[model samples]
Target chain A: MSAVATYVRLAWAWTRALAQYPASLAMLTAAQAVATVGELAALVFLFGHAGRLGGFGLHEALLVYGLAGLAFTLADLLMGSVERLGEHIRTGAFDVMLVRPVPALLQVAVEEFSPRRLGKVVPCAAALGWALAALPAEWTPLRAAAVPVLVASGTVICCSVWVIGACLQFVALDAREAANAVTYGGQAMAQYPLAVYGRDVARAATYVVPLAFVSWQPALYLLERPDPLGMPEWLRFAPPAVAALLALVAAAVWRAGLRRYRSTGS
Target chain B: MEAVIEAEGLGKDYTVAEGPLPRRRRRRVSAVRDVSFRVAPGEVVGYLGPNGAGKSTTLKMLIGILAPSAGRVRVAGLEPVRARTRLARRIGVVFGQRTTLWWDLPLRDSLALTRHLYRVPRADHARRLAELTEVLELGPFLATPVRQLSLGQRMRGDLAAALLHAPEVLVLDEPTIGLDVVSKTAIREFLLRLNAERGTTILLTTHDLGDVQRLCRRVMVIDGGRLAFDGGLAGLHAVAPSPRTLVVDLAAPAAPIAVAGARTVRVEGPRQWLELNGNPARVIAQVAADHEVADITLREPDIEEVVHRIYAGR
Candidate 1:
């Protein structure tokens, strides 16, 4: 079977299994939506006092926050289980995946698939739609096109970071926390204008992690704002390329980690 | 004969940490070293070793779960590590200590998932599932979640899941690790029938002697990261010191029983334990002619003893 088909089949099976417990699933999904809304509430309350964050008003800041939240949540929905590689490795479940006729990466990606994660999407989509309609920035065909491209490429970038972080489990075995620092922490860092964290942090997010491209650089173009770090204007269109390069790097790291894998004792 | 499973000097080296932090140094350790063996088609070979031996390492290399740090391995004419995904279609693996089935799903659902993962044809999957459910007796708990099933039931489910792909070769690790006699017997019988009917080549790594005695003709023993012995079960028996015993009950307490073919090793109140060197019947007859022999029971060497001898460098 093709890789996509196999992944869908595996994911679908898990989804069906999760559906068996309707009440618990509903409760968990409600909790997820409430959690996302709570985060947005904190952001909105901050805007109520400060009026502007890093020289961007409420809708402008919401645009960046929405794009980042949507991308991070999408990646989290798809590849969150990869973070549990350490647990699987310790328990030898990962070895079972290795012997299958499918790629281990694919197996790990779809593990514990739950539709409850879809709850996070609703608020982010609402915020992005509201911000897009309310923002005072001039809308152009090019800027409109950049929105989907930005979100898609950002999702890819976040997924790549997740895989790259998961590779640490093969060697360190307890690096999940360190990995979470990069992936979840990156999401937290991306939810505002990069300049809010100052110049050095902005440079690191831009060059080292490529997280700035997820929402910051592209949202700046949509907001018609100048680069806070004084970087080139063309960097707004750089997410897709950065995402592809990071994906290749992530794949290489994953292969190297798999090669270094020494399975648990029987 | 072309071997269905082949390994040439297959080895795995791990870098292990030693000592305390800051002063800790990494050391290169060989989990498996220079192990080579070939198994022909339709053969049930028992790969035996004590704990920490290289049995699992060898099996991992063969199944492509781990790449051998040195040497090579092939299963079903494909290099296991290089063509692991391709090779996986032709081999089924069961690690008795862990279940590959989804924990929260019912056994039937897990089996259905396996069918899709392996891409088994719908009709073939149905027929095979029916056969396995009947033979392994998985029907009663087919709808039970894997976590709720007993160990024996879970093992049967795991076996069904592994074989759902109709793999040409099956690799099982400790298939009967912890189970009651009845469950063990059921599994052994199922495996024997699988090999006989389908002619599936099996490389079983087990600490269970009964599993080996019942299902395998050829046995391989690995110790301290090397293949120590590999041959028939009878040959393994021969590697052990051949000291058969005859426990004979005498009518009265005696010093010892005098026999031509056996020597008295121990004496109780009314019984004598004689180590036989030749025909036990002749010894019993010789003792009966002179003394009142009440009863006699002969004991063969245990396979566990034979395996320990091999592991201890016999």
Candidate 2:
């Protein structure tokens, strides 16, 4: 079988096994959905008191939040198991992966197939739809076409960040917190307007980490809003390029890390 | 015969940091040093060592999991590290402490997934699965989750999983580590058949002397990151010459007995202990002729003593 088929089959097998415990799966999915809705509720309350925070109206903020949340959830569902690479390494389970004919990165990425993460996507997608309907911005053909591409780019960028964090396990061994900071923390930060953060923080998000390209900048383009930071206009079109570049660099780092891997003492 | 596995001066060094912060010093510890060996196709080689003897490290290198810090290794004519994926296709590995199968999934599901991962054809997979299920006796627990199976059952499952790909070489690290007598027998029989029938090149690192005695004709003893002895099992007695002990009971309290080929190491009351470097039967006859022998018992050296002597020589 091909690599893609193998991955899909493995993922399907995990999902089927998870489905065995219907109650726990349902409860976990519900908890994930409820937790994300609670975050959206906090945004609603903030918008109720203020017309707009950081020049983004309630609808525009929801657009960014929904897009970011969807991207993060999809990435986490697919690649969140990378966070456990350290544990696998320390426990010598990583040796099992190395002995397999498949690519280790692909194996690790699909190792933990959590179906509950899909629950978060439902709420995020609903919110994005609601925001799109409510926002008064012009719905041009080009802008309409860019929505799915932007979401895909965001997922790619988040997944790349996950890959990089997983690669760090070869060196750090205890990289959970660092990985969470880039993934979960980045997701939380990208939900709001980038303009609200300090100039240095904004630049870091734009250039260093590129979290802004995940949703904020893409949302600005989709919303047809002006760049509040007076940045380059091309920044709006940089998500796909940035995501591809990040993936390439992350893959290289992962390869280097694999080479440096001294398997745990059995 | 073509060498299925070859290593020349294979070694691994780990640089570990010591002490605190910026002033920490780096120390290089050699886990494996100047080790070299080759196994022809269908050869079952027993790699014997105590804990921390670098057996696992050498196996990891041969399986392409660890890159050697010095020298080189080739498995099936391919450099393990450079052609790891291709090498992986030709090799199957099992670590006794861990299972490659998914813990939560049933044995059948894990096997099915493995079939896809290795791209085993449907017909071949079905045939292989049936054969493994019957040979490993996985029928009862085929639907049972791996986590629920007993250690012995789980081990059988793992062994089957490792062989599902029909790998040319099967590298097992302590494959029979925590198994009962019955389980150990079952595994050994299966491995013997695997090697005999399939001509699989088997290199196993095991602490169980029974496993080595039953499965391997050629044994390699490693200690202190070096190969101490590598030869047939019978040659081990010569390398580590453990003296056999003879207890002879005389009718009365006897003076320290003297024998031509044996020495009396201890005497208590009417019994005397004689340590013999040569055959015990000849020495027993010599002692019987000299002294009034009421009873005589001879004890041969056990594997532990032989291994202990081997290590002690170092």
Question: Which one wins on DockQ?
Answer: 1
Off by over 4 Å in 2: B242-305
lDDT of 2 by residue, A1-266 (tens): 47788778878988888999999999999999999899999998898789798888899889998889889888988888888999889988788988888988888888878789888988999888998888687788887888899999999999999889878889989988887888888889998888878677778999989999988899888888788888888899999999999999998998899889998877
Tens-digit lDDT string for candidate 1 (B209-249): 77888999999988889888899988887776556789989
The local lDDT score (0 to 100) that residue A254 gets in candidate 1 is 97
Compared with the true structure, all predictions reach lDDT values of 0.89, 0.89
Residues forming the 10-long window of minimal summed lDDT in candidate 2 chain A: A1-10
- Model 1 ranges off by over 4 Å: B241-304, B311-313
Model 2 in CAPRI terms: which quality? medium
lDDT of 2 by residue, B1-314 (tens): 77899999999999999999989999999999999999999999999887888999999989888899999899999998888888887888888999999999999898888887787889998999999999999999999999999999999999998999899999999999889989999999999999999999899988777788899999998888999899998898678877878989999998999888888999999999989977777898888888888999987655557777997786
Clashes of 1: 0
> Residue B52 in model 1: shift from native, Å?
1.0
Supply candidate 1's per-residue lDDT for B62.
89
Q: For candidate 2, please provide the TM-score of chain A on its own.
A: 0.97
**TM-score for candidate 2 (chain B):** 0.82
